[model samples]
Target chain A: MLYNAFLQAIREIKRNMMRSALTAIGIVIGIASVIAMVNIGKGASASITQSVSKLGSNNLLILPGQTRGGPGGASSFAKPFKPNDLNVLKSSINTLEAVSPVENTSMTVVYKDQNYRTNIKGVNNDYFTVQSLEVDLGRKFEKSELRTGQSACIVGKTVVKKLFAPDENVLGQKIRLKNFSCVIVGTLVEKGANTFGGDQDDLILVPTKMFQRRISGNNNIHMITVSVKKNIPLEEAKLQIDQVLRESRHIKANDEADFTILSFTTLLDTISQITAILTVMLGAVAAISLIVGGVGIMNIMLVSVTERTREIGIRMAVGAMAADILIQFLIESVVLSALGGIVGVLLGLAITYGVAIGLDIQLILDPSITVLSLLFSMLIGVIFGISPARKAANMNPIDALRYE
Target chain B: MIKLAGITKTYGSGEVATQVLKGIDLQIEKGEFVAIMGPSGSGKSTLLNILGALDVPTEGDYSFMDTNIRGLSKDQLALFRRNILGFVFQGFNLLKKTSALANVEMPLIYQGVSAKERHKRALEVLSSVGLQERVDYDPGQLSGGEQQRVAIARAIVTRPKVLIADEPTGNLDTKRSHEIMQLITGFNREGITVVMVTHEEEMAEYASRIIRLRDGMIEKDGHHAV
Candidate 1:
């Protein structure tokens, strides 16, 4: 009996193709937007995780002052890290693999006639080891150069491309920085764009003493990068670093510490949490359209029931039970919604693919979400189809037959 | 065989209340060709609806073949309609867009008959109605008389014991009306009980017995001389 009803429902839908398509429009848009939003959100989250991990997952950052609402904004009472602080962390912390003090300032770098404004980072030899940076060409700064604060510097891939011709040997080439000249001793390997939209390769690296004496004229370091030893949990290393910094800076037990310790894992967690919330919010907004689509189905079904009163009467007189009529209409609605869901899925996947390619992120199609959206759309059909089906089933055959 | 006692049907309530079927009593025997005739506003159609089990009486005892039909549930009534009763309407209520063969096969579908058996039986009935060449034609493609024949084929496809027809020839011309009456009388002679409602005296003349209703009450009941 149900099979016959199903076949009849299909025939009815085909007979009123235009009306059926119009009725399904709401479901189509609802499911499509939901799929697109969730898929794009997932891709973005994956990209964030990848970029965060690329920056060395186990590395920890120690800022000179407490982190405020904005980056690099220190409190008036906070103090900066000195060279002695770097030594203290290196010698005292057993979990530390390397410690490097860093100071940065943007400067115009000139080589021949080309000049590009880029960040200039000043650090010790330990900075390269801490950041996992390897020289792709030439060699790192010699110990004599670091001790004497000579005018030898290393350029990143972006600086090398911006300063010299393609075939020009970047090593041994001279670049000028604000009336000072230095020879490029090495060119660092490429590191793609960071999550913050900054080019990781757009910088030049100089010895700490050279930057302090020749550039910023300051002995204070802005931040410290610490590499935790392998097999050491980040929490243990963080605790040890916190204790050592607190005691070395003479912080009182009752006072809040002046410096903040940030780990890559912590950063990754914060970013993931933010993206997860955004994804859910977008999905919820899209779901509203699906619900509206369900309402549309109910509305159309009601109208259809009324329009087919005489037909319902005829079926009833032909010995069709109330349940048969009910099932027939219900199946029609479910088939409508299920069709809408399928089209929406295809559209959503297409939109996701477009967005992933446009944003240059990996396409992550979550199978569970795809299946879930399909099921959810069908559920919408049933939930909204019941009242209309019941109204049709409960109609009196006598009156229905007499209805014009 | 069917029996009805004190059947009353009222519509609405309070100030708007109106009674469509007043207290009435009637009996119909098997294999009897009975015709119910009445003017407009009479309760002939209402009585037919009640007899078909399409509506329940407000107060009555309805017994069909010794079973108390008044106590039957909705599903049971449906089963009774499916197995024992057939109906024809003035509008030739064959489903639109459906072929004559499929329309004839509808009652059997409700009876849960297998597809092959339904097809075979429907084809045989269509042939009996002289519509074998037009079995696959939709009702809209057929003339009013041909449509009525298809309706009759659908009505008897299940070999039902009783056929209830409401205005079987109201929409037909003189020749078609007589032809439809001939079909009804032929089925009656084959031992199928038929109860039909018609306003035309000429159509009622073809029945074995005629009952005239006025204001929801029977005014005349007699055998028609052949």
Candidate 2:
């Protein structure tokens, strides 16, 4: 009986093909938008984590003072972490792998008249280990050069590509940083962009003394990045470092630590939490469209039941049980929604693919979501279809037959 | 065979109450051709509906082939209708967009007949009704007389124990009416118990027995024995 009803439903849908097509359009658009939103959101979140991980999981940033705001503000005179703080963490914490005090100077780098205004990071040789950067060409600075504060620099891949012609060897080439001439000893590999879409490989790295004595003319460090040993957990290392920094600055247990010890995992978790909230908000908005689509199904089904009153009467008078009548109409609604769901899935794929291509992100189609959407559409049809089908089924045969 | 005793049916309540069928007794044996005659609102249609198991009487004992139809559940009554009874209506009641062949096969579909067997049986019945050439034509494409013939073919194709037709020729002209009556009587001759409701006296005369109804009661039951 069910099989026959299915066949009957197919025939009836074909009978009103135009109406059916129009009815299914709502579901198609709803599912498509949902899929596109979720996938793009996933892609954005994945890219953020990837970019953050590339900057090394062990690194921490210690800005001047305790004021929490954007970069480049006044240092609140609240005893900033000096270069001495790096030495204190290194000597005190056994889990500490490397600590680099970093200072930045804005300089015009001129390589044979190819001048580019860029920020330069001044740090010791241990900066590479602390920041998880790798040399793509030549070699990193030696301990002697960093200790004596030699005027040698490492360029990132973006700088190398911008400063030199394609086939020209940039290593050992003389580049003028401000008034002082520094040779490029190495080129850093491309690290892509940060979460805020800033290029990570667009700057140059120089020895700390050159930036402090020649560029900035100060002994204070703007930020200190620390790396912990691989065997030790980050939380334990953070606690140990916090104690060292507090004691270095002579702050008592009653007083809050002046320096912010941001571990990489915490930052990743924070970003993930924000992304999840956004996803839920966006997904909820998309779900509204699905409900509207379900309403569309219900609306069209009611109209169908109204239009086919005579048909229902005929079926009943010809030995159809009320349940049979109910099944026929119910299956018709299900078939309509199921078809809408199928086409919606395909439409979603196309939309997701186009968005992925246009935005240049990876397209990850989650089949679990597709199946869920399909099932949801079917459920909507069944739930919304019952009242109309019952109305159609329970219609008085005599009155229905007499309907004009 | 069908039997009904003290069948009473009413609609509405209190001052608005309208009794559609009063206490009535009827018996129709197998192979009998019975025509119920009355004017509009005379309860002829209601009696036919009850006999076909399409409606239940408010008070009555209805038995068909020794099974008490009044005690049958809705689904069981639906099964009884599907397996043992067939109906023809004045509107022809053929599925409007479907071919005459499909219309004839509908009852058999309810009987769980296979598609191939259903098509063969539908074609055979359509040919028997003189619609062999128009078997694939939809009801709208056929003439009124042809549509009625198709409806009759649909009715008898199941070879049901009884055929209940309400106003089968009411929507037709005299010539078409004669043709429809001939088709129905021919099926009755083949041993199907035929019960029909009609206001036309000429249509009623064609039956071997004529049962007259007035104000929901049986006025007369006469045999023509032709």
Candidate 2 DockQ, CA atoms: 0.57
Clash-forming residue pairs, model 2: none
Clashing pairs in 1: none
Each prediction's DockQ? 0.70, 0.57
State in Å the error of residue A172, model 2: 9.0
lDDT of each residue in B136-168, candidate 1, tens digit only = 999999999999999999989989899999999
lDDT of 2 by residue, A125-227 (tens): 7788887788899888887777667788899988888889999999889998768899889999888877577888999998887677778777677788878
Model 2 C-alpha lDDT per residue in residues B1-226, reported as the tens digit of each score: 6789999999888999899999999888889999999878999998988898877889989998789999997778878888898889988888889999989988888788999999999999999989999998998899999999999988888888899999999999999999999999999998999999999988988899999999999999999966
Candidate 1 lDDT at A275 equals: 94
Model 1 is docked with a DockQ of 0.70
Give the TM-score between model 1's chain B and the true chain B. Answer: 0.98
Give candidate 2 misplaced runs (Cα > 4 Å): A62-78, A92-95, A105-115, A132-197, A215-217, A253-255
User: Candidate 1 chain B — worst ten consecutive residues by lDDT sum?
Assistant: B75-84
